[model samples]
Target chain A: MDKKIAMVDDDTDLLNIYKPVLEKAGYIIKTAFDSSEGLKLYKEFKPDVIFVDLSMEHFDSGFVLCHRIKSLPEAKKSKVIIMTSAGHETGIRFSTDTEEEKNWIKADDYLEKPISPRDLVQYLNEKIFKEK
Target chain B: MKIENGKILVVDDEKGMREGIRRILEIQGHKVDTTDSGALGIQKGIATEYDIYFIDLKMPDIEGTQVLREIKLMYPEAICVIVTAYASIDTAVETTRMGAYQYIPKPFEPDELQILVHRALERRWYILEARRLREEQAKHLLEVAHEQSRMRTIINALDDGILIINQEGQAVLFNPGFLKLLDINQEISIGEPVLEILPTALRDQIKEIFSGKGSVNAIKQEITIHPPAKLVVMANTTPVMGKKGELLGVVSVLRDISELKKIDIIRSQFVDMAAHELKSPLTAVQGYLELVVDKTLGDEPDLYDSYLKRSLDRTKSLVNLINDLLNITRLEAGKVRRELNRQNIKELIIDRLNFFKNDISERALKVNVDIDSNLCVDADRDDLLRLFTQIIANAVRYNKPNGQVNITGRQNTHYVKIDFQDTGLGIKKEEQDRLFEDFFRAKNEFTRNITGTGLGLTIAKKIVDAYAGKIKVESEYQKGSTFSVYLPFAKQNNFTIKNSP
Candidate 1:
């Protein structure tokens, strides 16, 4: 069976562009246009890997949705990746030391947008699809 | 009482006695007045401020003892002497009890009389000088107290928070500004330890300062107190050295710079957002062009054409974004020279309506114009034309099919107002506040398909503001939105034209 992945973002154009790029790399894809639908789909599909935009539906809603998934026992092994165009300026380093960094962005990995197709597939193979 | 010469009053039934007393006092450089009768003596005593009085017991109108008693009761400082011929031990004791200075026999000694007058004048001088010294001391004390109070008022009125600590690291003085800045409400007094009086973070700094480990100059920091509210402060701490070079205490002056820090953060965020915004379209253009050139569309004419079109569109949007950025920077930097002219607002609206005729007709938007032909606004012609073009274009672009756009103009004292009302995608109440902010656009289903650089309203607002005017919006989500601009009226015959440099 093909591994399942879900993407949540408010930007439809970017989502459309990303959908084929990820699916061409041989993975089943599901998408939600907003945070509410994203949460609904996350519970129903329970995808192995989730791609969430940082400010989807509302500011920092991606962090909120990721926290919900990570707190669930069933979703513990799922790879949650946070993507942002704003992170280009913020320089967000994923470290678990500080409480602020942990609470707001506790994800398995992070990606900055305008991500090349080649880099996206390689990052996915290494971070999510490696052990499986 | 006179210090150089004393004034004296003499009362006696014998004319010789009165003359003799007056001569003795006058020769001693004293001003002496005489009244033989006790009645006249009482009147003279009430009228004059005599320093000394000589009274006789044989007076017809009043006895010497009675006269002495009355004079003493009136002016307690008056020195009175009893010079009576009937003087005896009993008489002397009685007169002394009635407030007489001393007794003189019938054959009075000149030296004795002279000595008695001198003694009376000396006592008056001492009493007057003592009173003057006492008053001078009180005035000096009052002046010192007033000066200290004024100093205390000035210290408390300062805007910067000030904290003074003793050599033992105890808080000796804290101003109201200090308490307000720290948000501390408890009473702080002298000898309170720094840790007890200040926040823990500040206490650590103070401890470092006293121990000679902190910065010798001012230390600046941005701190968030109470979990959410952030404050930036510049604190200058210096040791107060005594005259003998002993360390007295530390003085800390705290100035709030949170507003300045906030502006810096906003400016940086604006720069980042602008860069990202510019990169987004460029990335899409690059990707599409690369796809077309690399023949990734599989040599299908339609696919190639579509990709090429998308690339061109993105390229166009990129150009528009750069233009908007340049416009905003030029506007903010005040580098754009304005050509002031008297512009007919009604004609301007008609011209814009004709300019956006295709978009308006495509959207089936009805145009309604209600304005006076002579309504004029003071503005830069090109800028005003651009301003109206943006507004009417937005009206046509954001309108629903078969929508109506009403352009109304009216003039009031000192100003002309032009309103653009569109039955289109209105903004949310919360989002409308930041609609004119740089790079802000309403993110919703309605605006998803609407093509905009999000800088139209920002530029429009900038233009209106440059004219020393105001722009405001009223909106109801999904119903309609109205954007109104108010501009100053130009005076007749004061028009001038120039190109933007």
Candidate 2:
């Protein structure tokens, strides 16, 4: 079966650009424009991997949504990735490398924005598929 | 030792006794005058303020006691010694009690007369010296009092709050600023304990200082006080030391840094928002361009056409955002060079409407204009054009199909009012207040697809403000929004059109 992925971002243009590229890599991708819709989409689709933007209607909406997803009993095996534009813009680094950071951020991994689709697929394969 | 010479007067009924006393006193470097009659002696004594007077107990015209009384009344500090032939203890004691320096015997030796003259001169010197010292002390006291009041006036005039507390933590001195900063309405008298009155954070810091646990160096802290109103102050408390290098008290200077703190918060928020806004377009442009460059969708040139078109649109918006940012910075920094001109409001509005003609027709927006022909304002032509362009573009862009955009201008005595009314999706009631803030956009289901830098109204408001004008908005959530701008009328017949070079 093809890998199911969920992506959430406020910018519709970015979602449109990335959706076709990711689907071409043989992944079934679902997208939402905001955190509430993203959460609702997560429950119904139960995608194997989730990508969340660090900011949406509110600055910390992605963190809140990720925490909600991690707290759900059904989200145990699903890997969550938080996409951050803030690291480049604000000079603040967000990472889930340490166990403490993973527990606090409730994210399996993080990626800086302006990420290329080629690198994104490679990162996913290395971290998610190879680990299994 | 240099002898301080004395002037002496001797009054005696016997001529031999008077001459004899004069001879003896004159040899002691004293100038002595003698008279046989008591009335002559009184006249001579009164004329010259002699340091000592030698008056016989039994005189002819005026009695010795009478001469003594008259001289003492004229010069209270005068030293008068009585010389009597009888030498009775009664007469000697009576003359002494009546302001006489001392009494001399009639059969006295030359040494006795000389010694008496020297002692009386010494006594006179001491009285004058004491009087001089008293005058100097009174003058010194007045100067000290004047200096203290001058210091008090200086402290009261300062804008920063100043508080001086004693080692016991009681307020010894405070200025009016202190009361204003701390929001203390009631009068605080000297020696009032101020530990309870201070905010908890500051009180704890002060307590640590008093306990000798805190650093002896000045403790600089930012403290917040809230109750009647929120206030933030930078409290710089230092230990006031004595001459012996011991702590006398603490002096805290509280500067109202609330304004600075507010500006700091706003600056950071603006930076964060600018970063986010700037990154979004770049991300989209990069993603679209990468797909075209890599030819991710299998070797067809036609497949990349749509991506390139979208990338162009994103790049255009990025340029627009940068221009808006620069305009705002220039406006805020007062660096915009403006050329004054008398601009007809009606003509300017029509020109701006022409610029938006394409967008208006594309959306099928109906444009209406009602303005007075002679209505004019004193403004830079380019600034006025930009201001009208922003509002007119918003009316067309935000309007629905077949929507109406009505532009009206009216002139009163001092101002010409221009109103832009659009039949479009208006702002929410809660979001209306934030409409003029930098980078604020009305993001909703309807406005989600609207392409704007979100700085149109902000720039429009700034341009209007530069002309000492006002901008107001009235909106209903689903109905529409009307933005009214009021500009002061240009002076009549003094119109000078100057263009920027």
Candidate 3:
């Protein structure tokens, strides 16, 4: 069965980029620019995979949204991933700055920026198919 | 055998008796000087610094009492024994009151004289010791006064407000800054309970800290007071520890972080302005691309096709950039609005995951979901779902070839948790710290070659905060990473899907 994935990010262009690549690879993609729209689709579509962005509206916007979904009773069975461009060196979750800005993580999983098409699908196959 | 180095002072208006006493003492290794008048006797006593003095009870010019007073004033420890003949015992006893060391009645033996001199010397030694102790006490009092002032001055000059409390939680020392911070004054004292001095809200925080449940910095709270007027202060309470690491008390510094606060507002404004400016053109470009891609003109569309495609790519990039910028700005601002509601956890994950199925298929990455589907959380649903979308996007965007990503969720009493596991190229342990920073990419140039605005995850974290949720990640380089999100649970025993605007 083709793996269906949902991509929730405020950036439409980034979401669309995956569309062409994943569609060519034989998978379906549903995209939303904000968590509100994403949640609606999350309930209705129940896609097999999801991609979340952290800096949606702020440093940890993705974290806030992912947390909401994770807390829901019915959504407990869903998987969410975090996306951030800054590498580990920029002190992603462990910045020495004030506690408020130091950490910005809260999702099912996270990845560095600039994801390649081959790498993206390979990872999904490993986590979803291999684990199951 | 006259007394060596002795010039005896014999003062008596009765000249014959003075001579008799002087002669008697001179015969026993002594040199004697006799004065008939009381005034001259005192003058002699003063001029000669004698070891011993013999004064008659009755003296005319300078009464015996007057002579004794002058002599005692000159030499406080001088030995002056009053000598009285028969029937003048009362006068001799009275003379002892006038600074005489002792009284000697007439018809006394030489042994009596010897004993009296020995007692007088012993008394003088006692006087010296007493004087020494008094001097020492004076110095100690002065030193204590000096030390007390120094301590008070330093306490006043310190940057933070300092209130010294005893074991009873009573304020022993409260500086001006401390008083001003707590809005207390003259009424506070050593035995007064700290609660009485501090505002009600602050007192509650102090109680929490004392119980060791919360940290001072972690609970840094802002309090606004309108007593003297309106003022905003961020109060941080730190427990002061003694040399033995005992909890001495607490010291709180209310530093004004207002400057940074204002700067954050300005930065957020910049982000909004930038998003608006970029989105306006991006929307136009997107519309134009849609129209052209639909072959609206029905002519040779090769040029239009490529132009539209390129425009679409550019617009997508612009959109990512704007979103990233906005995310960074919001998280830095520190305050996230909360619109609470219950959300379906499973639905949110699957929905977010669906966005990238095509990409996952093309890249051949596996996906897994292992979660107890009966979980729900109370939070802003919009922010929650977006949080999942961003993280999942990150996993796909940065996976190694032939890797897998697992998405799992579990429900507990108060929270719902989501876990995104990836078998892709995991983040390096050293580089994990900055993973959430805006626009920070990996050091590898090849990784940088991928198309990303480098703002995805940063925005995701901010969105999580808006929902009052927590996010965490675990990754091992070349192994994979797991990102987890936790949100408040639903109380109505059901999941409702909602989102923030």
lDDT of 3 by residue, B332-451 (tens): 666767577767787777887788888788788888888767677777777776677788887887887677888888876556778898887788887787877655555442253355
Which prediction has the highest TM-score against the true structure?
A: 2
Better of 1 and 3 by TM-score: 1
- Tell me how each candidate scores on DockQ against the true complex: 0.20, 0.32, 0.02
Candidate 2 residues B39-149, lDDT tens each? 888788888787778888787677889988988888888888888778888887788788888988778998887777778888977866776788888898888998899
Better of 2 and 3 by TM-score: 2
Model 2's DockQ score: 0.32
Candidate 2, A13-99: lDDT as tens digits: 888888988898888999988888989999999999999988765456788889899989999879888997763333223334457
Number of the top DockQ candidate: 2
Ranked candidates (lDDT, high to low): 2, 1, 3
Q: What are the per-residue Cα lDDT tens digits for candidate 1 across B212-286? A: 633343444444455226866666667666787666777887777788887777777667767767766665666
Question: What's the lDDT for candidate 1?
Answer: 0.77
Model 1 is docked with a DockQ of 0.20
Span of 10 residues, lowest total lDDT, candidate 3 chain B: B492-501
